[model samples]
Target chain A: MSALELAAAVFLLAGAGFYLAGTLGLLRFPDALSRLHALTKADNVGLLLVCIGLALLAGSLRQAALLLLVWLLALLAATVSAHVIARRALADGAEVEVRDGGGP
Target chain B: MRLGQRLVRGIVLYFALLLVWIVLDGTGDLVVGGAAAALGAWVGLLVAPSKPVRQRLLGALAFAGYFLVESFRGGIDVAWRAARRDLPIDPHLIRYRVSLPPGPARTLLAGALSLLPGTLTADSDDEGALLTIHAITPDPVNAVRALEARIAAWFILPREGAEQEGPT
Candidate 1:
């Protein structure tokens, strides 16, 4: 494969890894709020990486810019939805595990 | 907002929608594109009938740079924690009294903070006075306060009297 193609493949793999990590976080986190954190952060970054990889393979500037717009929209949606879910969890008075110090 | 300013904002939004339509539709058909863009802009204006927030271009660029770097850091940090055998999360919720006034700026700050490292904005009070955030780190209060300062700086707001202590 060409260098560009190889780079795209690497990015795609990294993006998939992030998405997997996000899912793992969702399953592992103790509460709804923490799960939201894991999902939003991982998915946003994953989408960003995927967008970059696809943009590199895109035929034209317009297509690349459109891919970026998609990433932006996804980021906005994730942020809004995460906030909404967290708010609902808070309102429900979900039990959250509180640890005092920074993790090792 | 002034009528003229609103009109200008609407026009700008209309053109932006047109550009998005062209990019997505991938067509050079002017008639359909123009009609759709106009309709979309009209709907947007109805939904959010206000002048866009004024942003300093340089400040916005700086904020974007900071945000991109920090978000990546945050993603890696969480990924590492998820991958470990023993989860190292010290999850806690802390209330922060927001210093920014009630407006788009405060909303922007809240949204941005949610994406930053080790912090997730859980809820805010009805009056928008206190924000309850979930953090995986020990010093969530300090982390959020630092981010708040960056956001305030990004919006070009003066930070003299707005600084306040975190809720205990």
Candidate 2:
């Protein structure tokens, strides 16, 4: 593959790795709020990186702009949904239980 | 601002959405795009009228820079903690008070804080005066404060006495 394609592949792989990390945090984190942090922050960066990679591969201005728009929409959705979930979780006292470092 | 000005804002929104629709659906669908844009602008006006803030273009550019760097850091931070065996985390919540008025500014702020480093914002108390933020670390207060200040710079906020009187 060409060097540009190679760079795109690197970004795509890194994005996937970040997505995995975010999912790991979602599964292992104790409470809803912490999970929200993982989902909103890590996953957002993951999507952003992936979009960049795909835009590079597409190599068309229209497609790249569309990818960017998709990422922006995802960011908006994630931010709003995370806030909703976090707010509800807090109201339900879901965060009342906190165990530092997975203590027994 | 009067109702007439809000109508003007709606017209601007209509054109903005029309351009977006044209980009998405192409020039062949002008009629559909125009009709949808008009409807969208109407709905937007009813749902949320534009609140005028003294926008700082330079501050917005600075904010964009800050957002990119912090979000990149945030992802790496999460990836590191999740990958480690120790799972080093000290999760807790704090009520971070904000000076921005109770409206779109605060909503946007809450949306932004959730994407920042180790912080997730929730509307728990104080009716937009305070944010209930959850952080994996013991103290994200300083980071949150810095972010808040950055975001605050984007707008010339209404003074204490002028807040009650809607957008001027």
Candidate of highest DockQ: 1
lDDT of each: 0.79, 0.80
- Which candidate has the highest lDDT of all? 2
After TM-score superposition, what is the CA distance of residue A67 in candidate 1 from its true location, in Å?
A: 1.3
In candidate 1, list every pair of residues with a backbone clash: none
TM-score of the A-chain for all models: 0.90, 0.89
Q: Rate residue A25 of model 2 by lDDT.
A: 91
Error of 1 at A5 (Å): 0.6
Worst 10 residues of 1 chain B by lDDT: B159-168
For model 1 the local lDDT of residue B55 reads 62
